[model samples]
Target: MNSSYDSLVDLFLKSLRAEKNASQNTVSAYANDLNQFFIFLQEHYRKKADGIELEVLSHYDIRSFLAYLHRAGYNKSSVARKLAALRKFYRFLNKEKLIANNPLFFINSPKKDKKLPRYLEEKQIEQLLALPDCSTPLGLRDRAMLETFYASGIRVSELVGLDLPQINLDLGYMVVYGKGAKERVVPLGSFAIEALQNYLRRGRPVLLATQNNDALFLNYKGVRISVRGVRLTVEKYVRRLADSLKISPHSLRHTFATHLMERGADLRVVQELLGHVSMATTQVYTHVTTSKMKEVYDKTHPRA
Candidate 1:
């Protein structure tokens, strides 16, 4: 790797971790995204990765890199994300006085298509959650995790980051540390609370064979369950019911938000519960529940 590029990449990621308090996942994604651009720069200029000097690159050079991505058959969304990563890296260079010119000034990101998030019907969610056998230790943990996913509407990262100290079963709330280390207290339903209590009493202790681990969910190794493990656990049941719809832990989070909006939960409130940094992020659910919103309007509004 080039001396300048390596230092700048390290600094950028350090800033992401220290200044923004970005999660490990975010750091890893940004590293991957930026490294991909580095590889593109190497290949485009017919130079080794360490030979490409980003500061000397032109606007056309950057645009060509983007063009290369398009030619490589990257999807619009993926390309946009890569572009975003590139833009941020350039901005970091600008801020650090490392570059003479900002090549991204002339570039614009492609417009993103509006795509509604996929969510399961209430019955589908019920069936999916019910598929876990709660009688066994692993089954109890899986049940609790699913219940919490639906009840809290948290990101998968937040789910796996949970510890015993963060949850308040008696108070029926949990402190979720979200993106940028922002904290929000989310309420839990009776079902989730009961599942958690049952798991804590019956399932967790049995799985708690290894000492000194504080994670709320554990695997057979008595280690904290990983995000992949959580996905696989969700997929096991999703596959049984996976006829037409796509379902994952993310789908469960989407289902939580959609169901809340369908039941007339306030948009801002849902935003807070979900720990979304912006109301605009939560507004997509309004679009998803357009039919339900229309039903409410038709039933209540005199004009309808």
Candidate 2:
């Protein structure tokens, strides 16, 4: 890209980090989306990106870009995400007076299909948790991780980001830094607390060895475990329990929320627990529970 485009993109990304507290993954996604848009502009205009000013771009250009994405085989969700990224970028530009107005301000996003989040059955969760052998260091750690996931409906990123000070075993709660660097306290269940205590006292030390890392979870090399490491550990145990299960650590999060909703937990409370900024995002679990109730009614109701 040319210097002008690079400068604007960098400035916008910096704002996302400094102002919005966007994560690295989020910033990178915005960057990728903006770069793709600029490339499309270059190809459409048959000139370098330096010649295409943000001021001259209209809603038609934005619509054309969406059309191009669709033609290039982008799905509705993918197109929607790209459009969202562009919308944000353009909004930032307008705020900074780099553009007179946001071209995407009036554009509509494609509707995304409503797909229910996958969750484990209570029996399956119990079986998966029991699969980890507590006697072994890795097993104890795995048990704690699994317990924590089911106890707190945090994202996988928040789970892997946990540090020693974040967890309070005595109080049965943990501090979580969720999206946008928002902080929330999530309660840990008795089972999770016990598992965590065991890991901290026995498993973690054995894994830590001589390492001075302050991470709550560590890899075999005695360092902080990566997100990929946690996924692999979960996958290993999941495969043993059921080869066709096809669930990730995230499924445990869904299970946590679903179980709570089934037990009459309030929607607003669940939203706070899940650290969802919008109640709309947490509303999906309602559909999950409602569907389950319908299934149970169909089976148990004599009149039906």
lDDT of each: 0.87, 0.90
Candidate 2, residues 137-239, lDDT tens digits: the string is 9889999999999999888889888999999999999999999999999999999999999999999999995656778988887788889998999899889
Model 1, clash count? 0
| Model 1 vs truth, CA RMSD | 7.1
The true-versus-predicted C-alpha distance at residue 47 of model 2, in Å, is 19
Q: Cα lDDT for residue 193, model 1? A: 99
lDDT of 2 at 18: 100
Q: What are the per-residue Cα lDDT tens digits for candidate 1 across 257-299?
A: 9999988899999999998888998899989899777887999
TM-score of each: 0.68, 0.70
lDDT score for candidate 2 against the true structure: 0.90
What is the clash tally of candidate 2? 0
Q: RMSDs, each prediction?
A: 7.1, 5.9
